[model samples]
Target chain A: MIQTVYIIGIGLIGGSLAKDIKKSRPDITIHGIDTSAQHLNEALELGIIDEKTTVEAIDKADLIILSTPVDAAVKLLPMLLDRVSDFGLVVDVGSTKSEICKVANAHAKRRNFLAMHPIAGTEFSGPKAAVANLFQQKTNIVCEIEKTAFKLQEKALNLFASLGMRMRYMHPESHDKHIAYMSHLSHISAFMLGKTVIEKEKNERDIFDMAGSGFESTVRLAKSSPAMWTPIFKQNKDNVIETLQEYISNLTHFKTLLESDDFEGVYKEMDETNYIKQILNGIQ
Target chain B: MIQTVYIIGIGLIGGSLAKDIKKSRPDITIHGIDTSAQHLNEALELGIIDEKTTVEAIDKADLIILSTPVDAAVKLLPMLLDRVSDFGLVVDVGSTKSEICKVANAHAKRRNFLAMHPIAGTEFSGPKAAVANLFQQKTNIVCEIEKTAFKLQEKALNLFASLGMRMRYMHPESHDKHIAYMSHLSHISAFMLGKTVIEKEKNERDIFDMAGSGFESTVRLAKSSPAMWTPIFKQNKDNVIETLQEYISNLTHFKTLLESDDFEGVYKEMDETNYIKQILNGIQ
Candidate 1:
């Protein structure tokens, strides 16, 4: 009589969810599917799920979770629409929501789908990157919630609540815009900073020895997998562009202040930005 | 008799150097000096130095260490030039070099002064921020080394070696430029990124709670002391500005690629930047 939950793309988020659910909720039987056989095998080995399932096995599940990369989520969601049962609930934990939501709009089981983005991840990826309590105390933003079936929304909210996540409701487009500034821009800045330093410091000795935790922390995401980010960037292109433009303009103004030897102005600029401490306080 | 070392403005860097020297060479007596009684008291309580000294004490010591903020270093060097004994060696560990180096150029004890920057620090600042191994295995960039007397150079090198730091030599101007890209730009990007996110996610609860280690790493420097960074930006205004300019331009180009939905181009950009992995490997 247990609820059957099937997960697509059993990587960090998916695998972590499976592990937590298996540990916390005895009545939920979890099924995991991944493109990588290694990930599937590891998920089984790690007891991340009760069993491994194929695409054909998805039809029997009462709830389906898409934890794949953004592009892959688009392709996988359509295939699952036909296989999902009448009572099935479907959700995706992709960074970009608008495109995926649009792609799934015409599906037969469109009302069964809920778009979700759990605002959590590390620079590291993969099933091995999965950790217990990964979603604990994190925020899971559910977009276009009104479009989802009422029963499915209730089920999804209850599941997220059990996993120790608070929820925020937003439209799909708004989620993409807000996330580009809060998340995507941060990754781009970190990556390019790493690139700039790496390009200039011809000898790796300089970066390895001279770069401190500050540089490492700032550039940590530069080490993130290209497979994951390439699609998110493509899907959230407009918002990312807008956010990056603002970021770049700010940097240019800062540069001009420095170029003019405007010591007071430069100091003032940094001081103004230091207000971020207050902003962080607000977010926390 | 053991050498007597006078450390002026004994804060984090100064206090740490004092601690290291005390640990390495018990025979060497370390005297601390600071305009701030609070810092002097904390340094005393921490046993970072043997005793507190006045400006007049510079003449009696075998070596004088300038460990204050950049502004303090600039103003104090002229006075120390007149007071220090002829055989005494003086070293200033300031973030910026050209300004401090230029001010000390015509001093009576010009050869007695060595302009050095230890490329090591933490987000914390002040006397309490001092840690025993802060400079261990780090790179210390010595600018305009040819300007320092041979005897003084030898003494400075030995002291840095005892502290377990490798050394790199560069002209003061070049050091500022290169470090602008590597160090200064990193801080600016971090501060502003923090600002942007805080601004956008004003009322979003648990926004920071959802921020995994990646966000923390990128924004770590945002927690740095405003007092410390305010002076640095003021002192290195021109170089910091120019570096910020280049960084912003690069970010703009990235934003353009993302906006155009150029997934392949985005993939290539990130992959190219990942070369930093090889660069980072050399540093550690």
Candidate 2:
């Protein structure tokens, strides 16, 4: 039943979805909307979307994806809910979900929207970085799926399923908190690790010359877009702060063990953390 | 001139080097030695080494590679240097250098020893995890090169270069200090990051279900062998402590910016750290 697709943010997540959906559903027309006219233009030239349109023409869309930064999505969701056609369904792919879900909850047309986050990305961002098959075998976390009308849920779920995503449903608050540990804290850890090393690279020129692939993998997330991450951290401030405190405490405890020559404790700590190997095996 | 390679620790690095050398230098035989008899057996079964070796038979080798844990290597280097033939070259692949180099310096056969740390590895360890070509395009940091005889240096350098590695030379003290920032801190950061998230996962069941590839990459080093890292930290305690202090301070500062709601500061910090993208580009 979904025919015309309107993606509100033509960035990495949005553009990638457009590319995948276009490949699978050639009969469907894809309309890309971005505040940056240049992005809309690039999306068109990249063949990611078939048309360009704005909020004024949103009612024509059978499926509308809200893929802006979390803050932008929060502000835009209510306005979008007010304008979408009765048959149209809206879904968001924001990293944080609590704030966006709260905004949607207050809307009269609450049943029209679904809050979902697909755990997929690279350090790179924007339309040019978009690629097909980004979502294959990736977990799609859907929050408050019961709030959306059952038929409209099918349309959205079908979209994700058709693209090879496995959906896991949860509450919006749970999504924000769990993601703080698994995703947000990892980003902060990487960014700060890069900052610490870059600060050292200033006084010593050859530090990077000795840096190996381990350094590269651990700091890879430091290259993520500030525009995308800053808002997620801001929105989930308390949870993120909680995770950071735990991380810093662990690092400080490690420093103490090293300072006091309690290498046995240090070894035990890392050996224990190596349990992540089993967890990561399950992930991959 | 190198015919027999006596590898003292048949773990990831030593076993990997043996596999590659055996492939490219079919005329040469690789003799495996390890505290773990199971590892020696695994190396033989995996075709990573040609013969079993002991220190008593070390003089038969033209090249001796000491690839033990840093603590073990510090204790073993002097013993190997004492027993090595005048024409035999001994080089170590210890993660920390100052201690090992100091140990080698006090010995009469110091010129027969070289201190090197090839920055290539995986989270896995031991002979069963070894793979050929792990050193291809990787950095091999050689410290105290001036202490090595010209011919012995060529013997070691040719071995690394033939395996397709790029070499960087530095003093032992400088190598430890720089690598503490470049390599050691990243491991601690990752191990501690893994520890914190695992603690949270105790209460939150679905935390990793939301973890993306970013989280996995950032914490991959947490899976590295604690036996290997514990000695590296012990041998370079002062440098590791300094880098950990810097890393903790940066994380605390970022948390403060988030707590104080300085979205602008948070954004600026990450934006500045994004410079790592360009630096990493140069590396790959």
Candidate 3:
């Protein structure tokens, strides 16, 4: 049984994990560390974590979760692993995996670290955005799971299972590539769409009055925190660029069809994409 | 009092209007007409309409509502107006307005027709998707309202008010232009995002397993019916193309920042767009 846990970057994902763990395992002591003192205070006030701590606290904990933005995690994971006790386990809950995994690949304590991506979140961020059961029924992708020590892997699996997550394993490279299309690209598309509309419609009231639920849904990701996302795009630059190119190409082709008044072509494209309904239903 | 109301193209918007009117003003008879006999049958069975009738039955109605696809509405609005009695009122709830209004501009009974677009609906379609109070608390854009006779305008206002809608008036050209930025472009952006992801991720389960609420919201418009949206894109081609160009430019600029690792620039862009949170709140 785990006696103590230390969660770094105690924002949405970290705070939420702490809440679920605290509920399920009351005997465990959950401590929080964050670069933002404001977030740390919020987590403590909200009872998401039992105490405030620092990297120096790693020696006393059985598990350490690096839940910072991807760039920060890449820089911090190896340094944190160096400080972990022999039996302590370290795992990162970042969106991108390739850079984080590569930075820690040859570290002396590499076997103590696990690279994970929990496929769940809201557009909101920070500790206040954390909620109970945020990870329930969600998919958790562990990249290069085989690189971790067997005992550490077991501990990570048990914790995620307790949070009601289904785990999938993939190579670091594969995880980054797949997520570029599925998740990161969607955020960029929404951000760009929001930027475009705001630039064109100078009268914000016109947009507020005229836009419908469809527009609301499509641009919802524009509200995401930039501090969290900018690092993600930087870390996964190549795959994101490739996905953006494909997305722009598709948009241009659609524009051409609209320009030429090819109604049938537009109709056929939307009809084909309608199959996404079935895929989305599967997720629900 | 509206003794009878005839709704053509009895699908989502039309069927929903029928349902709302029946609840709020049951003294009026609600009749539905659709090229799709299946939709007519469903609307009747759901009690969204009192009867399934044809254009031949339109002369007896006190009001006529054309809620067909824009292309079909462009053709039928003029023909339907030609058949309306002097005391009868005709209005359209099509997405695009310029083309439909232009086509009927020279009709002898131009004063009998009102061009309108209700700023509401779910991604779902067909009569089965109809909901009472769908227009409640929603804005309704009335294009070329002055072109309709004063009596007909008052009738349209009364019905929309009874259905709990706030009305805004604009010229047909302005309506098409503004909606292209506020609504049409959003749908295109979502459709292209969905297409790009589906094309790249051949394994559908990967997308299903990994996509979170953000991706789901961004792509929700992708599930819209092609039959409904295709004509809208075709009718508003110029404005749609212009909006698409602006959207593509924004996306390309974002991609360039990502390519150069300009994290600050990326962050600033999203930060500015975060103003959308206030705008969306206003919508709610």
Q: Specify the highest-TM-score model's number.
A: 2
* Model 2 / residue A97 / CA error / Å: 0.8
| Stretches of candidate 1 exceeding 4 Å from the true structure | A1-3, A26-29, A45-50, A146-159, A203-208, A281-284, B1-3, B25-30, B45-50, B144-159, B198-212, B234-238
> Chain A TM-scores, all candidates?
0.96, 0.98, 0.98
Worst 10 residues of 1 chain A by lDDT: A204-213
TM-score of predicted structure 3: 0.97
Chain B only: TM-score of model 2: 0.98
Give the per-residue Cα lDDT of candidate 1 at A91. Answer: 89
Q: Model 2 captures what fraction of native contacts? A: 0.93
Full ranking by DockQ: 2, 3, 1
User: Across residues A1-284, which tens digit of lDDT does each residue of candidate 3 receive?
Assistant: 67799999888898889998998889999999998999899899999999999998788889998999888888888779889988888989999998888888879888988889988889989999989998999999988888889987898789789999999888888888889988999999888888988887765466569988889899999999999999998888999999999999999999888887788899999999998898889889
lDDT tens string, model 2, B127-183?
988888999998899988998998999987997899988999889898998999999
lDDT of 2 by residue, A100-145 (tens): 8889889899999999999998888889989899999999999999
What is the per-residue lDDT of model 1 for residues A1-284, given as tens digits with 9 covering 90 to 100?
22898988888888888877777777899998888999889888878877988989887988898999998999888888887877888889999999999988978778989899887777767888888887877778888788888988898788777888888877888888877877888889988887677666666344355565567667888988889999998888878887787777677766666666766776676667666666556556
For model 3, the superposed segments whose C-alpha errors exceed 4 Å read: none
Output the number of the DockQ-best candidate: 2
Q: Give fnat of each prediction, in order.
A: 0.62, 0.93, 0.91
